[model samples]
Target: MKPLHLERCLRTVEADKAVLCSAARVPYYPLVVKKARGSWVEDADGNRYIDFLASAAAVNVGHCHPRVVEAVREQAEAFMSYTAVYMYHEPLVCLSEALCRITPGNFPKRVIYGLSGSDANDGAIKLARWTTGRSKIVAFQRSYHGSTYGALSLSSLSLPMRRRMGPFLPEVYHFPYPDTFRPPFSGTDEEIADYHLDLIRRAFADYIPGEEVAAVIIEPIQGDAGILVPPVSFMKGLRSLCNDHGILLIAEEVQQGFGRTGKWFGIEHFGIVPDAVILGKALGSGLPLSAIVAREDLMADWDAPAHCFTHAGNAVCCAAAYASVQVIEEEGLIARSEEMGNYLMERFRALQDSYPLIGDVRGKGLSIGVDLVKDGKTRERHGEAAAKICYQAWQKGLLLSFFSGSVLRIQPPLVITREEADRALEIIEEAMRDFLAGRISDEVLKTVKGW
Candidate 1:
């Protein structure tokens, strides 16, 4: 391993702590990044590591991709940005058309732009409410939409995120998200689907009537909640339920879009098309951009200046986003995601045979999660092991994060090569061995508090 020279990195972190607010931070390691290229990152201390988190799955095409960089450079040279609300730009119009065309939906679609997933999601909620004239919104338990007030009201994933921050948008309701591995119900996947669907049905019948609910927003694969992949039956059932009640179904693809889930969108895996698809993260190839593609008629009534922002659809960001989409298409990264995902999961399954702590390995495409358990029969969560493994992996030149205190988040960029993947697996296996042998200590775990 390259010796860690922490003087520069520590200095940077201390400087950041002096000025930056803690509310905007969720740091897992102290490694300060100086530069990143493709699937690798160089820390301020000059240590190189393979980046498996891929900047929280926002760099699906890999960091600093040539096309994305070139697009940004070209757009910046032409002009920086003007308020898109009043003016028209080629990059904005082109990207809007591209998103409407690629996202799942046969109807005429319109696009709304924003600077982050939270804002786009907030816009979606407003659009749903405006279109249906309903006051209530439905979301799943342990699902994280965003941090903005409207999105935060829809999120129930992190307690820390919601603590002391209430009177969250009234009329918002949350239901259980059917997690197949640690399922709420004791039966099979189909049974679990039925159980959650019944809860919604009963809610509509008794308390929150479906007619009052404007929309049901969900992540096709719950990212922050440990990469939970609900049964196909559950997604289809939810879609049908929304249809029966005239409730708009919004697919939150913030972390799972742009070829991260093997398909263009994660909802495509379940064979269902959402009324509105939220796109962010990988959509902009590291630029600040997010959007929602919905039916044209749904947004026809709500015209400009309603949910507009000053820098929502900046031209340079739109150029980077369009280039990112083109790279995913031309390079066949979507198919590559599937092939590499299968390879990585197969390796993990083999590793699980030797390591009993691994309770479950689940996900689609590059967005996989490895759940660590205390016991095979009881399947109790082993968050400590997850933390130690991540720390050890970092020590050995691999970078990743864990979620819900137990599951190891394994979402690497789609551009990762087989050789690089094998190396990362080796690092993880080494970390696992170290943890099992009591090589990693609690002193190290104290350095990071993972959510």
Candidate 2:
């Protein structure tokens, strides 16, 4: 088959099977990736974009970092899957130890492995309920946990994400997560903190008894719900409440972990240590791996084989994840992410001053969000404008995403240099210019709106 025809066939096959799951199918960017390295992605058709998306921060060490690839390759020479449940594996043991050592909490910690952030979170909930003997879980209104049944019940980022999905896990309650850009219920920081804090308190008082709640799961920096950074007071308040009630606090750090937040974990920025930390995305570079790092005492009671799975610690994936951590350490990418993040924020704030459509800019490290608005006064989500801007950028060979219809997610790989950052910003500025000058047409906006 011809190359173009082959690409079309692949897309058609996926489109027929995608079934409500959208993973950049069809003419989104004409990118049928041949390969990727570092922060650059090249299409089969030879188009290259400085990847600001970074596969949702999964390639923090960069796509196919040499160390991670070599680790996977070297491990493949020995074996691929030993199945952690069946026997011993050196890589798995090392990775687990690395996790226990690096994750927050001075107390002895243990690690449980999984294939995705969803299952890891589900496992965390299971452990919390089993350990605490409680059935109820507290989640946030605009938070996205994952796509699993339990996670869907917890997520409120986009209604369509859960529409007709089903009656989700019962006893999962939603409360406000403070948003500095769009304050919870539109109030001052202290007021927002107090309101959400009371909402949790009252949930235990009148709604669900505090004794019945097992865990209060949260995304330290809300990723899919438009990159919301909660007030520090709100997080401290939640920690205090959980302490008083004996409810476990689980921080879902799948997207924000692995130095994507300029720190090893997003919770570090909040100056809090969650009882358990859930991680994924960058855990194995581009490979599928995730883990739950919990206090030893917290996981000490769970019986074996209760949560054992076949591929939780696949050998090659473990090696990849281990190498990924090493790369982050040896190259000092965490500090790099922090420095680059600071520079990006400074540049973005200056651009915000020039653009009236940009309502707010906020992020930690490389995880950034730009809020688009219809106007400076109303601050209504300018979904159409965001769509236009993203399409204009895509046409100019830059890949980013907009969620909640108006928030531009600008998560570049940690390996990004100052020059690459400038190039990406130039593309964004040009796209914004197109939108402002009426060059971004209604037809282009309508065409990609559903995407």
**Pick by TM-score: which candidate is best?**
1
Alpha-carbon error at 200 in model 2, in Å? Answer: 0.8
Candidate with top lDDT is: 1
How close is each model in CA RMSD to the real structure?
1.0, 3.1
Worst 10 residues of 1 by lDDT: 1-10
Q: Per-residue alpha-carbon lDDT of model 1 for 1-451, expressed as tens digits?
A: 5657789998999999999999998777788999999999999988899989999999999999999999999999998899898889999999998998899989999998898999888998999999999989999899888899988999998888999989899988999999888776589999999999999999999999888999999998998899989999999999999999999999999999999989999999999989999988888889899998999999887966778988888999999999998999999999999999999999999999999999999999999999999999888999889988998899889997899889999999899999999999999999999999998889977677887
Ten-residue segment with the worst summed lDDT in candidate 2?
A: 1-10
**lDDT tens digits, residues 188-248, model 2?**
8878888879988987899799999999999999998888888888888899999999999
User: How big is the positional error of residue 115 in model 2, measured in Å on the Cα after superposition?
Assistant: 0.6
Each model's TM-score, in the order given?
Answer: 0.99, 0.94
